[model samples]
Target: MFKTQPYPHQQMAFDLFKDKSYFALFTDMGTGKTKMLLDIAAYKYNKKEIDCMVILAPKQVVPNWTFIEIEKHLGIPHTVAQFRNPMKVKEKEQIFNLYLSKKDIGLRILTMNIDAARCKDGFKCLSNFLAKFRCFLVIDESTSIKNPSASVTKNLLKLSRKAWTKAISTGYPAPQSCLDYYSQMEFLREGLSGFKSFFFYKCFYAITKKIRVKQQTREDEDKPKGFGREVTIVTGFKNQDKLTDLLDSFALRIKKEECLELPEKIDIPQIIELTTEQKKVYVEVAKRCMSELAEDQEITVTSAITKIMKLHQVACGHVKLDNGDWIDLPNNRLETLKNIVEELPDEKIIIWAHYKKDIENIHKMLGESSVTFYGDTVDTQASLAAFHNDPKIRYIIINPKSGMSGLTLVESSLNIYYSYSYNLEHWLQSRDRTHRIGQKNNVRYILFYCKGTVEEKILSALREKKQLSDEILNNITNYVKEGMKV
Candidate 1:
């Protein structure tokens, strides 16, 4: 028995099929698909059935596997290769060292980003790495290669032939059209759809309209080609039920809503210390805060409020420019949050941000897995429903001021605050979103605050249920009177 036990659905998925040469796990995000696949790999390596396993995922997600998943789940000696770039000489030597030091090792796992597949060096390095042993290949977020004409898709399709066993996994495999599944199915089995190429597969099932269209000759220009009657547009799909059945045959699909009986809410206070650059910036900002208190006696109340907001934003990692743009600063809050997210078990997470830019930055990092809802979210109800009902949506980032009340999001066992403001009502209401009825698990609240900064002052005021306007005035007055800088 393994130290980390599998969920019931995971166990059933593993038990249901172990003999397939190529497989697919079309499971939702936060449902532990990576662990299930790694468990299978560990079993094969232990039984001497396979000697090497190669995993590919999005670039940002590669570190989660390399530093957290592989190290914590399987404890396997693996190398995560950097593919997109001018590869460093040291990185090349590091990879070669791992390749050569395969003594008494159960299995050698080489992980890389999927986008790396397009580069010539990425193609050659992965091609050579796969040729050394009896390799098992797994492509995480397999939908990345859904485009039939994409260079990465073609590269992965060629590499798929080199492995004895291969697998691909994605939450929404056919996102826009059933046509999206063609390339993924082709990777699984050469003729799984009983068609050789995407053209034949689409022709067999799509309702197409042949129409001529103008071709682009250059930037900001369009002109009809000499021959313009060769184009075909898919008007609609045909035989979707049959397509679903075809996919159902090889893909092990599971919905988190149908499977997980999660635990109670747990609160975590994630304190991020200032980086070296942040520390320098903090001193400057602190001096400005004091200067605002001492020299800006005649400024309007609105200006005072704006200055306070700017100071808070600086503490949270970015400073808003006067030109309606933002300058990113060196703040440890984002990095701390990313590391904490990777260390935890995959579960639906809710991150609350007081600043809108904080919400945007976090969502950009997680891509589609995380959604943002604030003043900008036009369809709040639809966004709420998707976060509640859909398992693939792993995060709901809320500006608590906008989404604090009138919503119940008990699906999340963890709630993180990338940054907080001194609105006591907003904080109380946001905290209740995940602690309401029907929530069986303890909610975890992870708050990021920079030490020795104005952020702690706001947090203190919030804790005491005091208003920020009053607290800021009083704190500034006392600090100046006491001749203190911080």
Candidate 2:
């Protein structure tokens, strides 16, 4: 009773863990983890195992479950309720009550942002629903609850107790380190890692070192005294073989390269020469940052990042001054983008920018021929639909922060990075928006950076970080294989 045919990997994942009480799907982005979850839900519902399924996802990804994936994949009748507006308490309560009171035979589905589940009222509504109906609880992009001390993680752990089945899904589960798996696994099932507490789990897996830091204190005139304090920090991770074995027992990990015969990803770097005025501003910003560093005895990472961010902004053709006003500098980045668009006149292109100014400027430059999917867009779904369905819409200007996760932009095989963030997740997820399943052509990622600026440095750093992350992932995969042999 499936609407769309499932990929072999998706079917394999569902078949393996559909009946399990708890599992993790460590599938890569664009590998259709959402559809697999729905298939499992449908299988269990038809068997009278679960009366309802509740999906908790990011604020941006919540709607896709109700509007796209479920409608496209689930063949059985289902009543869907999505909690989009967390502020509408009365409306949400009425909808919840209506669903709870219904004597219908169809499967019940509710999707809500993970952020909402952390709140008092939102949690109350969900708790009430769970209390009334049998639920298969799933957390999409489960990394949101990676921090064990977070209130939302604690609340979700409590809520997980009520579910008949539980699952957590993410392309990159351990984005930073293996330590991220602690709270996420705990949410799936407490003591799943064999360790009773996070502290013990950390001690077992992490190699930590003690370091002394000078603690700042206000003594004489609001700031002066600095006393030394010792702190323990994670130097590296150990016992990966054991950790991989533990996770492999209950998790299915799939990478796009291994399962899909999809098109190759081509990286094209387009360097833009900054205008005279832009170069002047960039140099001035760099000098100021250096001066600030010289003046400050101890510069925090936050302040240092802020200083470097100014240099990035300058390279992007605009800089925010100390007075909270933006000064537009001269740059050829937009002109270069326009020329690239001209060259790809017949093809659809996705333009990604980190700054709001860049998005606005590109939108203005492209005009009606392009649609924007970002924070200021009134209807992101409509924008996405137009880009997907309309032939006239050849360009889609997007902010990676807003349009990065859970989006399928297969209509565009060409992705141009007008500006990018330092976030590796943003870069990876945004690139996959087009490169994922159903994309026919070889996906080309073109990055535009000003020559000899912080933009170049940022891109370099992202590549190095990605390489490190890939190495770690490969090591884990090898360890998992070795453990399987035993």
- lDDT (C-alpha, whole model) for all candidates: 0.72, 0.81
lDDT of 1 at 240: 79
lDDT of 1 at 9: 84
lDDT of 2: 0.81
Off by over 4 Å in 1: 75-84, 88-90, 212-230, 262-486
For model 1, how does the per-residue alpha-carbon lDDT over 110-181 read when each residue is reduced to its tens digit? Answer: 778788889988888778877877788888878778898999999898988888788888666764467888
RMSD, one per candidate, in order: 17.3, 7.3
Clashing pairs in 1: 263-441, 264-441, 264-442, 265-441, 265-442, 265-443, 266-442, 266-443, 266-444
lDDT of 2 at 351: 94
lDDT at position 458, candidate 2: 70
> How well does candidate 1 score on lDDT at residue 150?
94
lDDT of 2 at 116: 85
